[model samples]
Target: MSVGSENLPQFALVGGKGTGKSSLLESLVGKDFLPRGATRAPLVLNLRKSDCQEQGIFLHRPGEKIHDFSRIREEIANRTVILAGLVRLSLDCQPDNFVEQTKSTIMEYISKEETIILAVTAEGLVMSQALEQAMMVDPEGARTIGVITKLDRAQDIAMAELDNKVVPLKWGHVGVVLRSEAVKCWKY
Candidate 1:
């Protein structure tokens, strides 16, 4: 299908800082391509096939200044799910209004029939007010889903949050436990 005519499913990864958004992306794509640390602009990851090629695009916000990385394209693939155009938001210690831009950006994509996945860790429950509001904007949960990262770190709390509706994810919550970084060496 041609790029202009085809409407691919877009997913936005909304979360607070140090919540393992990049790590999840790297694991899903099977590569460490996304830049670590503060993410200045939202990115659109275009996944076409699973051959380990580099294919991605850095989306620019409306009326925002353009930069060298504003527009990018690469080809890559991996096992499991291959989702592109993953929008990411860094909501650490920033003003509430700052998230407006992110909400608008995601809303634009949702209006175009895209999906948004809110990524958050178990410890992030205390810091989920912003995310809760973000999800409430699409309260029916038609366009948003919640992902709980770092399950190993807070399994009990994660369960309680999801069960008690503390976070109240309309689409429900998915728990993920990443392997320990120290156990990298293979024993077999």
Candidate 2:
């Protein structure tokens, strides 16, 4: 599926730490129309000198503190970018005073930005409570895209179950499955 122009789609890579959000980011950058040898080993957005002229990939590593979002906010305000490895701060407590603060933090980061893509951890979605918190980060419907990573682990999750999650993927969006388990249908 293709991304629509009308929508300022925010792509989120939602999964655990090892779910390969970083690897996927590399893949996307590699696929971009970068000038030869412009891509660097460690992930960094060298937009002007970037080999990929078509797409701009920026990653915001906001340390555990929500206050660290200033750096990310600065980048959004400065230019057009596609953020990867973008994660939401996951908290367990009923932050009495911090809830609004957290939402405000996210809104501030998202406000007036031309585009923002989020990479999330699936662990946040496995339960109702976590899902609610996630909803705060990504509302019920916000043109936000989700990708569940780390299927390689999570024993209870079968390949079939994993397939179900992807089938519901919004058109033009991708729900990437990490590994392909051999299916028995072909030979029989």
Candidate 3:
């Protein structure tokens, strides 16, 4: 099927800084392609499932279409790209103004009825700004799915949230424990 012909499920990852949004994306793609640090603009990853040995990865920036596989990661990390697929909007919870801007951008998508994956740190679940924004926009939890990050840091609290005892949602919550830089070097 052609890209535009079929209606693919679009997921939007929304969260504040240090909330593991990029790490979740990396885990989904099974690669560490996204650059480390904060993202300036929203990223739309057009991922296609295929059986081919080699898959094509393209990055379309404003005024240029990049086809070089080696440059895809760098290009996406360095600048913004516009495409149609899964959208991930990072909320930088710093300097105050940026947070408001991020919230506005997220509201635009929410108005469009996009599926929202609200990322919240396990330790800060009750006070997570990301969760607050999501609940404010989607009080009924119709399109919001809470993602509890840093589960390893606070398993008990994360479990409570996952059980919906802390904050209930219609779609429910998912807990993810991503390895930190310090744990990356250690063996199982």
Candidate 4:
């Protein structure tokens, strides 16, 4: 793994809302609870509000300078990372260049394994191309893992489609949101 040398194993949680993704991370780490759309400004605001909480998570907000990456890197170097809620530039971003740069930054830092889990929120729409690009950015194959969230919400998808289209393609890596007590051990 070559990460932290002494801390916990790093993992990335990517999926849509109501998938219990945030709930899962909160349950696992017990700290650094960064909700989806955790931009840099709100993080700074939250950091200031905390005043002196030792344990915290650092996430990148869109419209921030790359030099701000130092704080995030320092946090990772110190092993304070729990989870990262990535802010996709495509959301409400006007200039195409900014979005492209944002994507570049995500790919760049992910390569260093700064945060354990790159938790992406898919939220109904299949952001497959975006995920593919992110994974492909890591040429060494940094153990890509993902979860297909909100299964409970997709009643229109049908059981037959679920069995064939969804299950076969997603079984190994993607976890369908099935509410059962016995179904645990979800790390993929």
Candidate 5:
């Protein structure tokens, strides 16, 4: 059964390229739901908990519900999917190179009172554009959750960041590490 868009809680994943936003979502779902490679547009995934053992994915358009995973990349790349449900919004990693249009778009979503912002950052990185934006919008960090990916590659600098010595968030931070190449899963 499908849940209505209005009923599901909204979560916006704001991170740069290669920050593992897609991977994080995939791991959470316990399946390879999103397509590989760079996400060109905002992909809204309506995740529903199922009682059955099997997992299913569907692409919802205006008049169609597609179950083929192979067509997902094309639909996203073509910007054909209707924007609804839980959205994963990706931003450029480099703050210096951040485009004004993208920044404005991100600002709009994060500023909303209902949207929960997932500020994702990678280990060994001092700062994240996503995190910086989230902090700017919500100074108290009440609705933002800091997700630190690639903990295996973390250095001493990362430890400081993790300890909240560098940047403190009211919600705090969670570190995740990729376990193995075969499994391609993260250990939180």
Candidate 6:
């Protein structure tokens, strides 16, 4: 069964490049459906609650396209679907960056009732800068939440920086230590 876009609450996951956005989504949706490489354009994962499966992915570039991946897990029946937001471009892109544009688009989709998760990695200072820019675009960050990925790779210095709250985020931080994988997914 397919759920219309209007009925669900959009839950976006915004962050800089290589912040483990796709990996987080795979963990949440309980499948390795989404591609971990750079997203070329915005895409919507059509998730259905009753079936506990990802029905299709609605790609937003080169016109809307749909792809089906059949993998169902019974454990997701009781859980609901919330839109996960991810930008198709890097936050540090030069010449013509799409971070601002993407944030604006996401702001339009989210209602006053929904929340947005900001994914940040503890490996660099760039994550903090990206968060600040996001806050500027969506002040109040009223419904924003921060997820700090790559806790396992954080060094003593990086851990100290995080502990000091060097870059203050309004919604607070939740650290996630992803298990080491053979592929070495993170790119900078």
Candidate 1 to native Cα RMSD, angstroms:
9.4
Q: Model 6: C-alpha RMSD to truth?
A: 9.0
Q: TM-score for each prediction?
A: 0.57, 0.38, 0.67, 0.43, 0.68, 0.58
Ranked by lDDT, top first: 5, 3, 1, 6, 4, 2
Query: What local lDDT does model 2 show for residue 58?
Result: 52
Model 5 has an lDDT value of 0.62
In the range 53-142, model 6's lDDT, one tens digit per residue, is: 335434322233323443222112111122223445444432254556666665555433544646455564434644554566565656
Task: Please list the residue runs of candidate 2 whose C-alpha ends up more than 4 Å from where it truly belongs after superposition.
Answer: 1-16, 31-107, 110-119, 122-124, 128-134, 155-188
- What C-alpha lDDT values do all the predictions have? 0.51, 0.36, 0.60, 0.40, 0.62, 0.51
What global local distance difference test value does model 2 have? Answer: 0.36
lDDT for residue 64 in candidate 2, whole number 0-100? 23
Question: Candidate 4 residues 49-84, lDDT tens each?
Answer: 133433233344433333233454454433322322
Cα displacement (Å) at residue 123, model 3:
2.4
Q: Where is model 2 poorest over a 10-residue stretch in terms of lDDT?
A: 179-188
The local lDDT score (0 to 100) that residue 139 gets in candidate 3 is 80
Model 4 residue runs over 4 Å out of place are 1-9, 13-24, 35-54, 57-96, 113-127, 138-142, 155-171, 176-188
User: 1-188, model 1: which lDDT tens digit per residue?
Assistant: 46651365655566665677666666666655554444444445454433554434323222232222223212122210133222344344544455566667655654455556555554745467436645556756665555667777777666765552665555666666543452121110
Candidate 4: lDDT of 170? 29
Cα deviation of 161, candidate 6, in Å: 6.1
Residue-level lDDT of model 2, residues 1-188, one tens digit each, is 88644354343333343555544554554432222221211223422223533333354442222222344334444432231222344344434444455445445444423434343333323342322433454453243434444434543433433343522223212334432442111100
- Tell me model 4's lDDT, rounded to 2 decimals: 0.40
Q: Itemize residue pairs with steric clashes in candidate 5.
A: none
lDDT of 6: 0.51
